[model samples]
Target: MAELLDDLRAETASFEALLRPLGDDDWERPTPAEGWAIRDQVSHLAWFDDAAGRAVTDPDGHRAALAGSGRGDGPGDVAAGGPAGSWVDALVLEARGRTPADLLAWFRTARARSIEVFTTLGARDRVPWYGPDMSGASFVTARLMETWAHGQDVADALGVTRPPTARLRHVASIGFRARPYSFAVRGLPAPAEPVRAELTMPDGAMWTAGPGDAESVVRGPVLDFCLAVTQRIHLSDTALEMAGSPAREWMEIAQAFAGPPGRGRAPVSG
Candidate 1:
């Protein structure tokens, strides 16, 4: 528990460091997320992190808070089998009035509270979320994944390339396990066939999932797999090699996060 929570803390702090130096103009810069500026990215994380804390410490209050505020990414937010976009838009509008400094402070306070609350959970404890309940460790990993994914958006907007970290294993793990949810959320039936993930980690270690002879395989750098699952980049743009119909089809619409059928980025044009 401590290890996972520690990683979550480290990931959140890393993102904070990135935001600390930005000014209002920088906050307003548009990211790959359609219609969301850098400020929106931070605000969304803050909103969800705050709610995550409330979910652990005060589940009823968490539900009530979301109910009062229009359920940003709530279960009822379904649209065309995906979570609605208005949820994030509503969250962004809530913080649009704050200056960069104020927003950053809000994010820091919210994240700190969430991490503190997470420390109280036992290994087997489950944390409630917008969609389904997740194990305490999974909850931490999910938070880490969310930060990395959104952080990618911020980095891309700034034309910055964050070096791959050992922490990417958390993101890749979620992407791999979410294969079923990925299909379900998109209103498609998850293929019964399992796809193997054979990825090379940042330090040249092999990370794998599924059976070796699964017939369908996605092999490449773990970083690219995470980016593809999060929809930060089109799969074809990555160096990943895909084989079998299941692997190819799954990669085309993979979504690691639980909200929407993401409007994944288009293939990079020359």
Candidate 2:
């Protein structure tokens, strides 16, 4: 849990560095996320982070707030085929009038409070989340994943290439473990066969998951796998190598996020 919190703090700092220098126009610029601007992205993160803190400190109040927010269904209530965008859109709407500075302040405060709350919890303590309860480690990792993914959108909007770091290992791990949920959310049966993930990290070290003898294998740079699973980059645009049917199919529809199927990016053409 301590290690995960360290990684989460690093990820948060990295993301904040990107947002710090953006001008008002940059904050309003459209990101790769459909219909969401940079401000919207930060707002969404702030809302969730605040909610996470509330979940730890006051579960009943958190549930009551969400219920009274006029958002019809919480993340846990959405059906497999439901419109995930609508739920997010409603949340963003609450912060619609806030300026970039306001959004950033809100995000920073919420994030700090969340980290503080997490630090005081016991290792075995579970926190309520949008979807389900999560351990302290898993909860922090989830925040890291969301921060990194949305940070990608901000980077894309500004045409800035944020270099991959070892922090991405967390995102990749989530993506790899989410393979089953990815299939299940789409109303498809998860393949019984295990799929192995062999990714080269930014520092040239290999991160392997699943059995070495697994027939289905996904091998590539860890950044590519993370981007592919996060739906930020089209699978066709990545250099990832898929060696089996299950691996290939999973790559095609990979979604590390908890929601309905995402409208993944389209392949870029020459």
Q: Each candidate: what lDDT?
A: 0.82, 0.82
TM-score of 1: 0.92
The per-prediction CA RMSD against the true structure, in angstroms, equals 2.9, 3.0
Per-prediction backbone clash count: 0, 0
TM-scores for all predictions: 0.92, 0.91
Per-residue error for 31 in candidate 1, Å, reads: 1.0
Candidate 1, residues 1-270, lDDT tens digits: the string is: 888888888888788777877877999998877677899888888878887888999877776776677554543212112334565566678889988888888889999998999899886787767677788888888889888888888888898889898899989988899899888876898689979999999999999999888999999999999998878888878999999999999998888887757667778955
Expressed as tens digits, the lDDT of each residue in 1-270 for candidate 2 is 788888889989988999999888889898876677889889988988888888889977766765676542345211112254577777777888998899999999999999998887775678765555667667778789888988888888889999999998999988898899888888999789999999999999999999999999999999999998888888888889999998999899887777557777868854
Candidate with maximal TM-score: 1
Report the backbone clash tally of model 1.
Answer: 0
**Model 2 per-residue lDDT at 44:** 84
